[model samples]
Target: MELLETMLRSISAFTLMMLIARILGKSTIAQMTYHDFVAVITLGAITANLAFNNTISIRILLTSLLTFTGIAYLLMFFSMKNRKLRSWFSGKPTVLIQEGKIMESNMRKLKITLDTLNQELRGKNIFNIQEVQYAVLELNGSISVLPKPESQPVTRKDLHLKNQSEPAFPIELIMDGDIIDANLQQNDITREWLHSQIKKKGLSIENVNYAVISSNGNLYFDEYKDQIEHPVDKE
Candidate 1:
């Protein structure tokens, strides 16, 4: 009877800890305040210790976890209910770029270096910072950018183009130098046809680094590998 009681007590503590964690949900280190993050970690560690410590009272652990969770829930609820409070806790979005100009002051405030900002801009295919109209720094420490009107690519609406056919389905061609045979067969394309295309680029299908066939029958291939030197691993 004593053994069964101990087992039941441990199981109950485990269940209680899990329930509290589930209620709190997920948030990144950048999103969570220092106090909130520390509290969550401390609560989890204490609960873990309590689970293994048979002598420590389960009531104490349960009470503390429940209290931490309840407070978190209340704070989240309050953040949602009040606009000013939400802004105060979560922070206002910082405008990094306005009217195609970089706001250096805002960037400094966010503590994000110019190199990191430029890297993100390059990922979005905006090579020149001057091309960007507005880039807002979100609370999640991510940038959302708007390109200048003059630099914006022409859309179907801009061209006055109307599509009568069904939406195009993306057809996978080559992934990491490996030809997707299933995609080729599904798209009614032959291996010989693919080889012909690769040969035109002065390469073979086996040598292709990456390629894709868009739903609109547009073939994009990147066969030539540019050698990038890495100081850490390079001889």
Candidate 2:
């Protein structure tokens, strides 16, 4: 009976956690703000105790979870409505670099070192800080960089070229031999058209391991039986 109770407790706690996480939306761990970080940690700690701590009552655990989630929801609601509250809770983005000049005062206030700044800059494919016109340290601890005019990627406008190309919103049509019906519907594509494309490749939908509609409306597919040599692991 004790073992059965333990199993039941684990399952219940797991289900409750999934439901609560869904309510919190899909912000990944790296994207979570300071408040979200604390909330996630607290939730995990609470859920862990609820699942494994035999002494804690299910009623108390459930109540605590619901209360915490409710409070979190309220905080989100108020923060959205009030700028001051939002600023206080979520904080604001800091200017780390502006016009090729490092904001030393802002960096010092943010407790960021020169090396750390350089490392982040390198991560953004920027080795030289002088190339950056603007660099914003986001609330989520990510650096958003705007390169200097001379360092920026050359575009069609720069070359005086016209009709370069339209934006290509590629859509995944099939994955693991399963058709993504929603994507097809979103892209206004029919299964008949897809089948016709597959025929051109001398294959069928079931033979496809993965498929995508490219920007040029071309159907690209990888057949399940296609043999391709993978690169050796470098890492």
Candidate 3:
């Protein structure tokens, strides 16, 4: 009974620690910023101590969990409330490339190398560095690529094509297993409309993976046929 009680307490502590991480913010686990590298190290240390300390009391476990959660929640709240605080907590984006030229000073300051830049560019489907008009290294450790003007694809507007209609913000009627009523309401569409469309597409709400309505009345959709879900991959 004592062993069982210890097991339960350990599980509870570990679960609470994870719950705090989730509430803190969304970040790609595959990508790590400089701050994230430190966080990973710190979390490993704390969790390792908790795991090995067999004689540790339940009070200690709960206290540590609460303290960690409270501090993170408060910091996130403050960051959201104050721009200065937000900037301090989360550094501003750095321009890695400007006007087809690498920002060497900014790159070096961020410990960014040409090889790393190339890797980031390859992830964005741009093979040639010269093709990049602007590249911003985001605080979240993702790369945003802007192609050079001549290298960019020709848009309809560039060819003097007139599109005189309000753009549609695609409504997701269903996600995973939940029906999104709020999305339908915002689009001024009814549940019945969604039901009919799903039926016409030979897809039930449960089978519908994703759906979107483009500005020009283009209906785009993807079915979540796979049981496994994946998070967004960052460069």
Q: Which ten residues in a row have the lowest lDDT in candidate 3?
A: 162-171
| Candidate 2 stretches greater than 4 Å from native | 28-30, 161-235
Instruction: Output the lDDT of residue 141, model 1.
Output: 62
Clashing pairs in 1: none
Report the lDDT tens digits of candidate 3 across residue range 1-235.
7677667656765776577567655652454444445555665556655655667765675576566556656656776566557668767778898767899999889899999999999999999999987898887789988787567677767588553443232345664445667767877888788778888988887777667775357766677775457866673
Q: Which rank order by lDDT, best down to worst? A: 2, 1, 3
Off by over 4 Å in 1: 1-18, 21-57, 161-235
Q: For every model shown, what is its TM-score relative to the native structure?
A: 0.52, 0.64, 0.59
* Residue pairs with backbone atoms closer than 3 Å in model 3 (clashes): 168-215, 209-224
Pick the TM-score winner. 2
- Give me the runs in candidate 3 sitting further than 4 Å from their true place: 1-6, 25-44, 161-235
Better of 1 and 3 by TM-score: 3
**Decoy 2 TM-score against native:** 0.64
Candidate RMSDs in order: 17.2, 13.3, 11.7
